[model samples]
Target: MKINFTHKLKILHPFFYVVALCFLSTKAEEDNTDLRFATQPTHQTAVLGSTVVLPCRVIPRDGTVQWTRDGFGLGTIRRLDGFDRYSMIGSNEEGDFSLKISPVTLEDDSEYQCQVSSKKGPKLRSRVARLTVFVPPESPSISPSPEVSATAGVNVTIKCESIGGRPAPELSLRFL
Candidate 1:
């Protein structure tokens, strides 16, 4: 028995078409897996010995999350001593990307970047967020003696001094 050429061609053509459709569908799915920032990184400030959270969010939550500091790029956290000081807080369930700094200090104050990337997409970065650390006020002191012994008609000068005070400090004096 001889197979009909046109009949064989018709079946093969449909088979080829189905295979092409499957391949194209996979490509479309891969293309759709793109990393996007639902909420860009925002500026954050913390007192020098306080904790702070920097906010970053990604949509779809189907990508690897990373945290990096100045001069680093597209990296994940590694374990070591004192790792508790810095950490990434978020999960696929919440779709949140955030950085937490505990007992933030001057070292933690710098520009930070949050990166996310899908399995088939390039790494994407959020807007740079700045971490500003404020040093609390120390015990203020008075210069030239807070208490001065003066005789009648004598001129005394009092000066108040402050160190490590945020937003500067206003010195005031009360005379009785």
Candidate 2:
């Protein structure tokens, strides 16, 4: 049996089309796989009523980035709604989706992550980064009511204490 050229071409046309489609699809998948976090957010320490930035950057810039706090989504927009202090900093063109919190409060202390989702790839999440907010201690107080007198060659004990401080305040005593 001999097959004509036109018939052979017709039979192979579908196979060639399928092969090309698969190749293109694979290329697209490879490109999506390249989408990754170039810079991940790191642990941050911020003072109460201050501002802080959690850095995050993705390469290839082909995906949507969002910030999550304690596993809760904060949306993918530049500024989060209902959150006056929460916003996204850095340039979107550069793939920097850093989260910024102005006037950080004690409530802002929590774990945060940068998440990236692409059309053709699985969602990517950065390592958890903790935000620690420090609150200054109140005025320290000394026992003995401002003045204490002791006889010569006698030992006197004084106590100093500070209240309402995060991470606890270190206390040191100096004698004048």
List model 1 lDDT by residue over 95-130, tens digit each.
786777887978887888888767777778888888
What TM-score fits each model? 0.70, 0.80
Worst 10 contiguous positions by lDDT, candidate 1: 73-82
Query: What residue runs in model 1 are displaced by over 4 Å at the alpha carbon?
Result: 1-26, 73-82, 143-155, 166-176
Give each model's clash number: 0, 0
> Candidate 2 local accuracy as lDDT?
0.90
Indicate the residue-level lDDT of 124 in model 2.
90
Best by TM-score: 2
Question: What are the RMSD figures for all models against the true structure?
Answer: 5.8, 4.3
Best by lDDT: 2
